[model samples]
Target: MNGTISLFSAEASGPGLADLAGVLCGPGRMAGFGRTAARLSAVVDEPWRAHALARECRRRGAEAQVSAAECGRPLVRTPFRVDLLSLERRWCRGEGKVLPEGFRLDGGMLRLWALAAGSPQGNNYLLALDPEAPETYERLIAALAQLGVPAKVQRGEEALLRVTGRRRLLRVLELIGDAPLGAEAAWPSPVPVVRAV
Candidate 1:
């Protein structure tokens, strides 16, 4: 077998459900809600984030819908998909969603996360994280470094992983592929290099 992760593979395309990890990144969560059918949901501040997440779900063969949430935010949720029960098993540890063992980050995963949590702060691109999950943030830093992109964690109520510099920002943008429609404001911008003429 070839030594590469295929986009078609079920094991999340890179290693350990990276595609699904994208779904769980940021404020996303999976819940069984006292039943066998599991659902994934997240409250995103921007309308574009909700729409983008719904599209990502559809791309993975899951039906998702966007709805208004409290605090005037938009929420993207999947119907109680019995199919997602397996994911719930991996991510849901009793109450909170936790990263599974051997978790790795991939482009698709980064794309989904950047939709809901990425932003440019000054010269750095910041990817938000759940402050409660310190381990997850730690692992994320390691994973990005493995991909040749070093990141630093800025802890706070809403923690952030800061990716700085032109080359690193470009690398991050390359990893996430393309920005979704209406995400121009929420996504990071890599300033084009200008030769001093």
Candidate 2:
């Protein structure tokens, strides 16, 4: 399983994420996550939805920025964690199984599992693990529905990690720089194998 995490953005600079940071740390903590990137990655046919997500993040308590990408799948930056994407990747695949449909077994597009948080704006957080095979999409949807945060698997058309190694995620940020856009196009960062030793 691969690990990856994402935050919402608004105004192309991650207003949603900024808002989240403000609320969580009581001001000025937004920078803990880092600056926002210029562009970001999203499920292939859902740029607008992605935009909505960024706005939502601002509403939560953090700031976000987009990163650039040749494939068009964007990335973002934050100040709270070490290698946000890599951290997210570790969270997702660490305890989860490989999702058959939403994402590939190897690190490719991010496969997220959102849970209901009960917040007024809609409480949902991503699960660290990927989905397991034979775990029908319908079942996952039903589970999320029970939690009150309905979700669908988000996969992209582009294969960002076909032959790439997991360590490439770190290089992504280096390659892009602080343009706040595509500074790190690394999609799914390296994660410990779910069942492998």
Candidate 3:
């Protein structure tokens, strides 16, 4: 499954709440959980992303809320629930994001990350990495490579992973599936998919 980037096959079934890991991968954080409970908050660039992420969290059985942050960015977050404890423990390393020893990226997780901070620049797709947690960048890039989406870390004001080449971009589409409804960022490059009628 790690060799010969094929666009047809599915990656292995991910573990419980693996999609939530994507939030930590980007700008999301597993915090605010103590007296009231624990919450997972993700600040996104668009309103559609707020709704999309909330819906995904609900689909995963978490109660979610979407609202605009003080910075005016839309924020989607889950309520303090005991169910999220394991996730917080796994992703938080003393207040920083860190992948568990063996975490896998699935379509849902990839979609969440894309919704959070991914964008398309020309023919290449760029995924923003956490500037605070520079240590996890290599692991993330390696994980993407294992999933057949080879990417390189592009250092800048904010670090990013740029996925280049046509086949690799197509492979990204296959792995992450279709774009979210009402999505405007178009990280996967939402093209007019034609069908044979």
Assess every candidate by TM-score: 0.82, 0.29, 0.83
lDDT of 3 by residue, 1-197 (tens): 13542332323343236577777788888884664457799887778878988877876778789998989989898878777788888787786888888977766678678878887876678898888889988999988888788999998788999998777877787776666577645556634333334
Clashes of 3: 2
Maximum-TM-score candidate: 3
- For all predictions, the C-alpha RMSD in Å is 5.6, 17.9, 5.6
161 in model 3: Cα distance from truth in Å? 0.8
Overall local distance difference test of candidate 2: 0.27
Model 1 ranges with Cα > 4 A deviation: 1-18, 33-35, 192-197
lDDT of 3 at 40: 91
Candidate models: Cα lDDT each: 0.74, 0.27, 0.76
Native-referenced Cα lDDT, model 1 = 0.74
Q: What is the lDDT of residue 75 in candidate 2?
A: 34
Which tens-of-lDDT digit does each residue in 1-114 have in candidate 2?
A: 213322221222323222221111100111222332221222212343234334444444534454444567533333354433332332233334222233211101111111
Residue 61 local lDDT, model 2 = 51
